[model samples]
Target: MSASQALGGPSRCGWVLGPSLDKIIKNVAWRKHSQLVAACKSALDKLDSVVDDPVDPASCTPLYGLSTSDTDFVLQPLIMALDSASPKVVEPALDCSFRLFSLGLIRCEIDTPTPTPSPSPSPNPSSHSHIFRLIDSVCKCGALGDEAIELAVLRVLLSAIRSPYVLVRGDCLVHIVRSCYNVYLGGMNGTNQICAKSVLAQMMIIVFTRVEENSMMVDFKTVSVAELLEFTDRNLNEGSSIQIAQNFLNEIVDVKSKEGIAESKLCLQLEYDNSEKKGEPIDGEPGEGADLSGYSKIREDGFMLFKNLCKLSMKFSSQEHGDDNILLRGKVLSLELLKVIMDNAGPIWRSNERSSVVKSVDTSVNLDNKEDAASDDLCISKPRRSTRIVIPPKRLDSYLWAGRKSREQGKS
Candidate 1:
């Protein structure tokens, strides 16, 4: 029998899936955990035949044709299932949801056309809206702490990044970046906050390292450092923007360190004499003399991103005043970020340049101290000077003299 016929015809396919979903919702509402698990399994099995393992693409027609209400009805229970404590229920629900998502059958929202006097009112929402919804759902689901669920969420995100639809891919990238910024800024809480932090780190590693691989099929055009910074600045407050700028700088330093290690290994491999293994395929060995050329673009983009971040942090450090916790944290993170960047990208910004940046940062910190002292005249008899100064090695004289020169210039 054809797939639709096997599910009692396309018209009745919803019927086959609906009862199980309804039971899931009912059991969940009643707190009947065992029954809810069973219902979820049954729903997943039906979904597999109809959506996941259809005889052909046409077999999913019934699902695609579901009315907006019916579609919402089907999705509601699955979303609820994602919140269940039981892994059995959460796993099946996630699978069913991902299947529906991949097949473009999930309509995240229904758009009702407003009656317009004009001939052309705008286009309906893009079909890819479902991808965003799916991501949001998976990331916010309570079961995200589960290792399996976390992996599934990461897989969904990476797959979306590789989507053939340019709109879908670009939107997904922007959504992930925005979500990361939101989490960092404390705009999100609970499971969503945790999921965003974990996913962003993993996604950064993948995008910076393996995204250009032809085997991965990820469109490299969607990953732009400038666009990332733009989105981050748009989404974050001034203080949070500085914090995220430092965060990106740290990530770049990390990737550059890894690349440096890989290059060192490649050099050692090339120097080793392997004449005894004449017939061996030298390139086949994993990480042995592998091509590093693909990463050159990433490295250049990373350096450009680093330069922009430095400028941003410096701007904020010079402009922002007071001892606000967020601002203080941003300053600390920026200092650490500069240290890491100097360690990793020292060739690009020389040792003397590093000392200059440090000196500039130290001056900003002291300015903050003077402002703090001025505010508390009743609590203190005299304006205190910071005894401890941060000085980079072999550059004590420059840092000390630069700070004194700046102070004398301000006094004069």
Candidate 2:
């Protein structure tokens, strides 16, 4: 008989060692720094062996047979270790967690059978919970340290987001938004903020692509555009959200151009130039062609986000006191964001009647303010050049104030 059979089957084997593993994991929290690091390294080494096993299927891996509760028990301590002050403990903890996450994904695959002509298969509940807990842990790790840890956290996140299991991907999406919002509002600086924004940008691309292809596993209702906008709005004071929004809009613009703006505008346009063309309406069920409804919804939501940011910018500008350099910086960032948004979403802007009318009004105003050569020569431009030179010092002051604010916020 095989070793598994001799041990009274995989389930029995799991039951036998579960308690021992449980005890070891529990003691991890109480161990001294050195002992804790050693334990994490030991656990990681063992897990690495199983994870790297080429001969055994996932079901035959060491972690596959543990019950859900036992699995969680084993995972909880390692996850907590990710927050350890020592990099030695956190690194091994991160590795161990990632290996466990991989095994969980494998277990999920084995539990869920291939689809036939029947109804769609649901994800395994135990595996779903396991994966979600791990995802949350990894998300928390994003704020732990500098470049190395952030890169590691990002690697874990990318794996989860790109997971073949739809449920895992969906859970990943939710946690990413939560993590981004937390990191942004928590006023994390330097690498932490960069990591959060990078992850957010990556998630936006994946979500947008999924929606475009009608392959998104979760409903937009679950992770609504409104919630995403709030996440962006909350970080406006720091200007990171503006950068995030700018990157997303840039991607949307590129995608629209590559996919052909005419196709996307089909649903947006009130009247089509080709009246002779007859087919299903753009809103109707797509036969052989791709659906345009998704594109339309994306455009609507993108514009909504853009509009809200603009309003927030105005609100911040109006509320700014001379001493509040933070608000002043926010306004500058918002202006930069507006410039980028207009450039990137030009197609959408041009399609809007109000924008076109505003553009015309601005052109007329500029023309009305035009100066003659004699008058322009009489007005020295030195003051304008001097004002431009003064901006850098003001920007430096705002940045210093922002850093102080972040530190105070953290202290609070």
Maximum-TM-score candidate: 2
The residue pairs found clashing in candidate 2 are none
* Per-residue C-alpha lDDT of model 1 across residues 189-251, encoded as one tens digit per residue: 333333333344434444433222312223232223233333122333344443443443333
Clash count in backbone of candidate 1 = 0
Clashes of each: 0, 0
**Residue 258 lDDT in candidate 2:** 14
What residue runs in model 2 are displaced by over 4 Å at the alpha carbon? 1-70, 83-86, 96-127, 143-147, 166-175, 181-195, 216-412
TM-score of each: 0.34, 0.39
Best by lDDT: 2
Candidate 1: regions farther than 4 A off: 1-70, 83-88, 100-131, 142-145, 169-173, 178-412
Candidate 2: tens digits of C-alpha lDDT, residues 1-412: 2454322123332323233334444445554655544544454333322322234323322234444444454454555566554455455555544433332332332112223532532324444454455566667776765445655565455444433222233224545555554453343454444444444444444444443333323222112222333323344434554454345333322221111223223321321222123222221111334233323332323333344434434544532373465555454444333333332223324444422321221122111112231111101011112111112233333332343345346448
Report residue 160 deviation for candidate 1 (angstroms).
2.7
